[model samples]
Target: MIVRPALCTIVLTLVTVAVHAKTPVATGTGGAVATISEQASQSALAILDRGGNAIDAAVAAAATLGVTDPFSCGIGGGGFMVVYLAKEKRVITIDHRETAPASFTPSSFTANGKELDFDTTVASGLSVGVPGTVRGWHEALQRYGTMSFAQVLAPAIRVAGDGFTVNDNFTRMVTENTAKFSRFPATAALYLEDGKAIPAGTLLRNPDMAKAYRALATGGVRAFYEGPLAQAIVDAVNRPATKAGSAVMGGAMTLADLANYEARLRPAVRTTYRGYELYGMPLPGSGGVAVGEALNILEGFELGKLPRAQAEHLYLEASRLAFADRNAYLADPEYVEAPVAGLLSKDYAAKRRALIDGRKAPTASVAAGDPYAFQRDASVPLRPLPAKGKLLREGAHTTHLTVADKEGNIVAYTFTIESWGGSGIVVPGYGFLLNNELTDFDFTGPHPNVPEAGKRPRSSMAPTIALRDGKPAFTVGSPGGATIITTVLQTIVNHVDFGMPMDDAIAAPRLSQRNGATTDVEPGFAGTAQAHALARYGHRWSSAPEEIGAANAIVFNPDGTVTAVSERRRHGIGSALVQNKAH
Candidate 1:
C-alpha cells in the first residue's frame, strides 16, 4: 500500500497526547447557542454570542465541520438541510441531494446482464452524483441567515488556510483508510507525502480548498460550479488514467452538469406518532418514510409496557418491514415510482407488525405487509452484482449538526462524501474530497436503485425538525447511511416516548438492522438478553465500535431554554450556550 505523510501529523500527535493527559472541562449555555464538534461548537457559540441567529450559528458550525471532519463532509459533497423559520412559521426542506450525470443509465455498470461488485460499481467516477451541499447552504443563507456566505465560511477558510490541530478520531480514520487515498494520484499528493500517513496531532492545512472557498465567497455557488473549479473536476475525471480500464471511471460530467445542478426546496414529510408531529426529508430520501413506518408499526405494540427484550423484538420487526419496502419501492421519485403514502400508512404498518413472532426470529425473507399492488418480481432480469460483502458495501462517515435560535428558528443539516473520505479522489487545486455517492445506486439493471440520467440517488440523510403545539420543539439528525434512520428513530423514541433528557437520549445505545443483519446493542444498553434472543431467530449478531454514527440534537424545553447534546460514542462533544444568561 502507498503511504503518504499527512501535513498535520506531528502537531496532531502532540495535541492529542496533551488533550488526553488533561481532563476536559465543561463549557458554554441558555438563550442562544450552538453545539457540534468540540471546536466547531465553540465557533458556533461565538457566532451566537455575536447576536447571530440560528442560521448563522448553523452555517458557522457546518463550515467548521467541513474542515475538522473532512472525511465525512466537505463542499465537494452534497446533503439535505431542514430549516424552521420561526418568523414565517415555515419549515422548509432543502433537497440538495446529489444527482446523476446526464449520460448516466441503468446499465452503466452492468456487464452482459450481470451486476458488478458493489464497490467496483459505486467507487469510481461512474458513481458520483451531482453535489448540492454548497447550493443548499447558499440558499439557506440567502433566505433566512443574517450573515453573508463569506462571513459564515470565514471560520472554515481560516481553519483550512492557517491549519488546525488534527484530533484522535480523524487521525485514526486517516491512518486506517490510507489505502483508499493511494488509488488516486491527486488524492495521494494532497493527503499524504513521502509515503507515510499523517499521524495524530498534526497541523494540517488545505490552501487549495481554502482558495476555492474564497472564490466561492466572492462569487457565490456559481464560482465553484461554473468557474475554474468546475473545469478542474471535468479535467480530472477525463484524465487518461481515469479511463484507462474497462471500468466506468470517466464519462460525461461536463461543465454543463456542474453549471446546471441546483438545490431545490420542498415540503418536509410530516407524520404524527403518539402525540408529537415528526418531520423529515422526503422523496429522494427513504429515511423519512422508513423511520415513520417503523414508528407507526411499533406503535401497534405497547413498547412502554413490554420487557426490554420484547421491545427489541418489536423494533427489529418494524425495521425488517420498513427495509423490505425500502428495497422494493423506494427510489428517487423524480425518476421512479415510490409507495410513499402506502408505506407510511398506519394500516400497512399494523399488517406488517403482525408478522413478528416475538418468540423467535423470522427467516431471512419473511413477508412484511405489502403496499397496494407491490409485486415481488422474482422473474426480473438479473444484473451483474458487485463482488463485495455487505460490510464493504456499507457507506458511512458523515457529519450532523442541529441549531436553534431564541426566535425559534432551527436548522438540522447532515453532510457527507459518501464513505470514509469518499473514493479518496481529490481534484487537483481543489483540496477537497469528491463523493463516491454514486455507489449508493444499484449497478445492476432492473433494481429500483439502478442509475439513470438526471436521477437523484437514494439517500438515508434524514435531517429533521419537529414542531410541537405549532412551534419548533426539536431538531435532530445523524450520519450513518442505512443506520441513519434507525439512529434518529431511536433518539426520537428515547426523548418523546421515554422522556429522557437530550443528552441521555442521544447517549443511548443504538442498534441497527442493515440488509437483514442486526447489529447488537451499542454502549449504555441495559439489556443483553435481547441480543441473545435475537440470535435464536437466525439473526447474526456483531458488535459495532463506538464510532458508528454520531447523532447531534437540540431540544427546546417547555421553559424556552435549549438543551443540545452530541453523541459521545463517536467522540462527539457538544456545547450549550444561552443568550442573555450570566456566564
Candidate 2:
C-alpha cells in the first residue's frame, strides 16, 4: 500500500502526547521504528503488525529504504548492524562493510608513487568494492527474523514496482550530481527523463530493481551473490566510461569477490557510561572503539552542571583524543593490530583526558595517544601508523534506522554507498547504484587504513545501542560520515544527562570534531552565549554554515512503551505503534 500519496511534500508529523518533560512528541505504546524516510518506517511498523519480530521489522524497513532513499543506501552498498536479542540477553554485531578487490594494493590509485586525482578516482570504476548488503540482510533474516527473505523484501519490491513520489531533497541531489549521473549511460537512462533530471513530486518506479528483488526473494541470496546479479555488478564496475581511448576507468572486482563476501557477526565493542552499558562495532571499523573511548573520557565530567561552552569544549577535547587514535590505530584488524581494549579503557582515557589544557585550544598533535602506555604489554606489536594526506571527510551521505519490538528485540542499522549517487554506475539490467567504497582507503599511504587485497575498508558507520540496568535504554545513530561519532555521542549525552526528550535530544544543535582545531557546528549553535564561552577556551568554530550530522533514535520508555524520533533537521520520518481506541 502507498502509505502516503507523495512523501516529498508530506512531512510526517505525529501527534504529540507529551505527559512529562521527558516525553517525546513522537511516541507509541507497543513498539517503534524510525528512519530517514516515513514510508520505510510505516513499512516496518506494518511488518510488526503482521507478526514480525524486531529483526524482521528492521529488515523490512532497511529494504524499503533502498527504494525510497536510494541516494544514501541500496542493495549495492554495505554496512554494520547491531541487534539486541532479549531471549539470549546478548548483542549480535554484524560487519557487512565492503572490502577491497582481490587486486587492491596501497598504490592502486597512485601514479609514479604519487596519489591520483581524488575527484577522478571517486568518479571512476576504480572506487567500486564488493557489496555485502544483500548477503547481510539474508543472514540477518535467516538467523534472527521470523519472516522469510521473500516476506521481508515484499514491501521494497512493491514500492519499486508501483512507484513512490520523489521528495525535494531527491530532486536537489540529482541536480547537484547531474554531471556524474550523466557520465554513465546506465545512470543517465535510469535517473533522467527527456534529457533532464526528473523533478520532485513525480511518481518514479524502477521495474529493474523490482525484478532484482523478485529474483532475490525467489532464488534466495544465491541469485544476488553468485548468480546473474553478481555478473551485472562485475561487468558494470570493470567497464568504466572513460574517454574513448583513455586508460581503463574501472576496478578489478570479480564475481568471485561478490560470492566470497560474508556478513560476519563479531563481538560488540562494550563499555560503560553513566551507569549504562554501551555497545558498538569493533575494528575493521573503529566506530565502537572511538565511541567507547570518548564516553570513557566524558564519564569523568559532570556535563549537566557545566555551561554550554564548557560542555562543547569538553566534548571537543574528548573527540579529538578519540579520533587521534581513530586516524592512527583504527583499521581493518586483519591488516593492523588495533589496541581495542587499551583504547577504550577508563584508565587510558583518564591519562589522555589530563592532557587537555582548559586554557588553550587543543591540536591533533597529541592524537594517536599511547593506548599501550596503559596496557599490560607496553611492547604490543601493533604500532600506530601515521595518518597522512589531507584528513578524509566523509560527506553527509548515509542512512540509519532503529527498530524495537514489544518482544524486547531491537536493532540499530547503518548503511552507505560512500557518497551521493554512489559511483553513478547502475547495472545494465538492475536499477541500483554501485558503491565507491574503495575511495575510503588512502590511495598511496602506509596508514593502517591503506588499501590491501581482500581487506574490508575501515568505516565510520557506527550503529549503537545502549542499555541501562541490562535493559534497553535507547538506540541511536546518524548519516554524517566522520560527523556520525559526535552526532550520536551528543544525542546519548542529551538524553542521559540533560534529560531531554527523545525528539529533542535527536534534534538538538550539534558539533563535530574530526581531529582538528576548528569544529563544525550546526548553524546558529555557535552564535549563542555558550559558543562564545567556548571561543574563550580556543574552540574556534568553522565559519562555513554547514550542518553537522542528523540522527534517528528509538528510546524505551519507563512505562514499557517505546518512542521513535527522526532528525527534524532532515527530510525523514518516525512512528510508534499505538492501539486504535476506535478499533
Candidate 3:
C-alpha cells in the first residue's frame, strides 16, 4: 500500500488518542457502543451501558435522529441499514426504502399533459412516498435487539418532550432555507415563528411527535402503520391545507399503502477489492454498484504507487465510468435490469479503466464502456425529464450513525425526512416530520425512476460496512443525497488504502464524481496554484464550498480499541469509550 512515513505515523498517533473531537470512540475491546447525532449518541451509549447490543443501540439512535435531526431524517422518511452479525459472520441488508403511494402514477406530477416544474412536483403531497423509517427500525429491533420497543424509543420521547437547544447548524440551515419553509403553514409553524427563523439554543419541543413515539413504543411498528397514527396520517394528507394548489399536483395517501408497506431483508452487495471485502446496499440504491464499479476500475491502475497527479487522474476517470453507468443502467432492480453483478465485475472495470489518459480529464459526454452490454437489451429506459438547471432540495439536512460492538456486530444506518424538516408537514397529532422523498424520483414520465404504484424511488442513501477476514473492520455512511456513495468510497480509500486515521480520513479534502466533474476541495486547498493545476486537466472548478457530505465512521482495531471519526464539514461529532484499565 502507498504510505507516507510521516503521514502514516501521524495517523497512528491520532488513532492512539484516548479522546479527540470528531473521531470515533469505544470503551472495552468488545463492549457495546453507539455513535450518531451528538444528542442521540449519548442516548444510544446509555442503551449500550444498560445491556443492549448493537441492534438495540441502533434503534435508540434512530429514534433520537427522528427527534433531534428531524429536518433531514425522521420516522416520516425511509432509509436502509447494513447490519453485521458477529456470530453468524453474515451481513444483512435492510431495505426500508420509501415506495410510491397506491395513488401515485406515472402522470401524478403532470398538468395539461406536461411535466410540472421541479419545485411544484417536489414539495406538495404528490411528492411524498410511502415512509419506511418506522417499519424498518422495528424490523431490525425485533430480529436482533435484546431490548423492547419502549426501551429503545423512550430516549427519543424524552428529547422531544423536554426539548433540546437548537445547535448552530440547525439555526443556520433554518435561516438559509426559510423561504421553502414559509411556503407551507405546518412547516413554518414548527420551524419558523413571527416571520423569523428560530435562533440557536431556542428550546424546540414537539409534544405531538412525543405522543406518536409513545404510541410506537407501546404498540410496536404496527401502531404506526396500522393503528391510530396511521389514521392521523390519512387525515393529514386528506386535509384541504395539505392539498396541492391549482399550480401544482396534489395527493391522498391511502391507508392501504401504509398497512401493506413491508421492509425487506436482502443480501448486501459484496465485492472483493485488493483482498478486502466491501459490503454496501443493493439495488433500489445505485450506491453500492457505483462505488464498486469506481473502485474496481481504479484497481486496474497502480494507484498505490502513483504520485498525487496520477492518482487524481485515476480517481477522476473511475468516477466518470461509475457515474456514466449510474445514469445509464442503475435503478430499482425490481422494475428494471440493473446489472448489479456485471457492472461490478473485475473484467468490466479493467476494460473501462483502460480508457483513462493519465494526462487530461475528458468531457462530460465521453462514453465509458458498457459493462453490462450482454443485458443491454433487457435494461429499462430511464424516464426522460426536461433539461432544467441543477435542482437541490431544501433541508438537505440528514444524519449518519456508525456502531461496532465488541461482539463484532457492526451497524451503518442512515435516515432522512428528505428535505429540511420534511415539507414542514407535521400531522397535528403525530408530532413528527413527514418525508418529501418522493421528490427524489423524476416527476416526468418515460424514465425508469418515474413515480408508479408501489414502486420504490431511487435513493442515494448508502449505509455500508466493510469486513476483513470475516470480521468487522469498518462501518461508515453519509448524508449527501447523490454524493453519499462518493463520500463513503473516498473515506474507505482514506482508511484502507492510504492508512489515514479516522479523523483525517473524514476531514481530508475530497471530490465527488457523481454529478458531472464536481471538485469539492476544502477552502485552503482551492488556492490559485491548485486551481491552475486543475485547469490544466480541463477541470472547471466551481466556487462551491466543500461542504459536500457529512460522514461518520468506526474502525475496529484488533487489539480491542475502537476508533471513530465524524465529519468536520458540518456540526457532527464522534465519541468512543476506551478501556482505561487495559491501556
Candidate 4:
C-alpha cells in the first residue's frame, strides 16, 4: 500500500471525533427504517410488520415514491435494486435499466457530419427509452417477497387516486421544468395550472395512474408491458409532437422492444474498504465500479487521522483518477465488453495511484489509464477520444430508497427518469410520464458508451450497501447527475474511514472532482481549514450550493438497531418504523 505518515495520523484524529458524533441509535425493535419519504417508508415498514421480507418493503416504497415524487421516478422510468438476502446471506443486483429503441441508429443524432442540438433531442419523442421499472418490481417481488403484488402496491395506488399534498421538492422541480412541460400539452396539463407551475401544498390526484397501478396489481408485470397498458405506452412513445418538435425518423419505438424488455439478475460488484466489504451495482451503470476504484486508491491513506481539508485533497485526487477511467472505459457490458475485473483490481489502483502527486493537483483533464495489465483475455480497454464537447449534466433528478427489516434483509434501490420532467410527455390517459433516458446516450460520438439498441446507458446512480465483519452494516445512495459516484463515495469514506456517524455522514458537506482542475463543494463546508490546502498541490476550487447530491442512508447498529437519515438538502424524511404491538 502507498503510505504517507501525515495522512494516517490525521485520519486517526477524525476517527476519534466520529465516534462521538451525535447521530441517533435505532433498534430493530422499531421494526424497520426507511430513509427517504415517510409516507412511502411507513408503507414499507407496515409490510415488514405484517411479516413481509425486505424485498416486499422495498417494492412498496419504490412504488409509493413513483406516486409521491413523480418527476424523479415512476413506472415511466427504470432503475437498479441491490439486495442482501438475509436467508441467503448473499448480495444480488437487479438490472432494470432502460434500453434504446430497436430503431435507433448511429447517425440518429447527427446531421451533415455534426451532432444535433441536445436540447432538440431531449424535447422530442426521440429521447424516450424502453422503460423497465415495472419488470424490476415484479421480479423482486416474485423472487424474494412474501406479500401479494396488490398488498405491496396498495399504498401507491391509494396515493395516486386520493392525491398527495405537494412539497417543496415537488413545487421546485415543476417550476424548473415549466418550459419543458409547456412544450408538451399533455404534460403541461398535469403539473402546470393556470399556465403556471403548481404551488407547494397543492393536493394533486392522478386517477389515470391509479387505474394503471390497478392493472399491474391485477395482472402482474405483463399488464404493463404486454397488453392494453403496453399499447398505451407505445402510442405515447410514438405520439406526434408540435411542428417545433422533431419528426425524427429513428424516433419510432417498437412493440417488440417493450414486450421483450427483461430485468436481468446481474452480479453485484464487491470491494474491500477499511475492512468492510462494499457492494454496489455493476455494468451499464458506472456507480459501483467507479466508487470501488476511487475507494481502492484512497484506501492507502489514513483518512480519519488527517485534517479534513488534507483528507479531502486525497479524495479529490482519487476521484479524479477514477472518473478518468469512468468517462473513458465504462459502457454497457453486453455491447462493449467492459473490463470490470481490471478496473477494480487493487494492483490497477496502485498503478493509477502513481499519477496522483501530493505536491500538485491535476491541471488538465486526466485521461483513462491502461487497466488491461491486470486483465487476462479481457477486451482491450476502450481508449477515450477527446470529448466532442462538454455533455450536458443529466440533472439531479432521481430518487433513492433503502430498507432494513427486522429479519436482517436489506435493500438499496435507485431509479430515475433521466432529467427534470423526463421527456415532458405524459402517456395520455395513463397519466404517467416517460423517461428521457436516451438523453443519457452520447448524442453523436465514437465513444464506448455510444447509443446502441438493447444497450443500457451508463448511469451514475449508486445504490450501495456495505457489510462489516460479515454482516450487513450500512446502506447509502444518491441522485446528483454525474456527481453521484463521488457523492456515494464520500459518504462511505466519511462513515467508514473518518468515523462519522451515519446521519452526519449523509449530511456532511461534499466535494467532487470529475477529472478537472476545479473541485466543486457545497456552500458552508466545514473543511475550510484545508480549503486552499491543495493549492500547493496544483488544485483550484470553487464553492457552489447543493450542486452535488442528496444522499439517503441507513446504518445498522451492532445492538440490532439502525440509524436512518433522509437528506435535508431536499424534501426527504427519515423514520424508523415501530410496529404497533397491537398489529
For residue 347, what is the lDDT in candidate 1?
Answer: 77
Measured by TM-score, how close is model 4 to the native structure? Answer: 0.90
How would you encode candidate 1's per-residue C-alpha lDDT over 118-197 as one tens digit per residue?
76544466656667888888888888889887887887788777767666666677776766665666666655555456
Cα RMSDs, all models: 5.2, 5.3, 9.0, 10.5
Error of 2 at 410 (Å): 0.3
Candidate 1: where is the Cα deviation over 4 Å? Answer: 1-36, 121-123, 240-248, 373-392, 515-517, 520-530, 533-539, 543-546, 572-583
The candidate maximizing TM-score is 2
Better of 1 and 4 by TM-score: 4
Q: What's the lDDT of the predicted structure labeled candidate 3?
A: 0.71
Query: What TM-score fits each model?
Result: 0.88, 0.92, 0.89, 0.90
lDDT of each residue in 1-583, candidate 4, tens digit only: 1111221110000011111111122444545555456667767877887888888988888888787778888899999999998888899999999998888887767789898887767766788889999999989988888887899999888878766666666778889888777776667667776557776656667777888899988998889888888887787778633326524322688789889999989999999998899999998889999999999999888888887767878888999888888887787888876777888999999998888876567668777877776766534655435343333356568888888777778899999887877787777667788888887877667777788878788888889999999998889998877788888998888888888887778777777888765777776653565555656566666645455666777777787666666665544334444443211
Q: Report how far off residue 545 is in candidate 4 (Å).
A: 3.9
lDDT of 1 at 531: 55
Off by over 4 Å in 3: 1-28, 32-36, 240-249, 373-396, 515-525, 528-532, 572-583
Judged by whole-model lDDT over C-alpha atoms, candidate 4 comes out at: 0.77
Candidate 3 C-alpha lDDT tens digits along 1-583? 1111221110001122122243344435555343446667767777777778888888888888787777778888888888999899899988998888888788877789886776655556666778899889888988987888899888888988876666667777788667666665556666665656776656677667788889988888899899678877766555514324433335679899999999989899888777788898898877788888888987776666766556765676677667777766656777866667668888788778778877888765445355554334454344233223232332345667876655667788887877666655666656676777887776674566777888887777778787788767777788887778778888777676677876788777766654464555556666666466766777655577547667877777788677656655555454444322144
Best by lDDT: 2
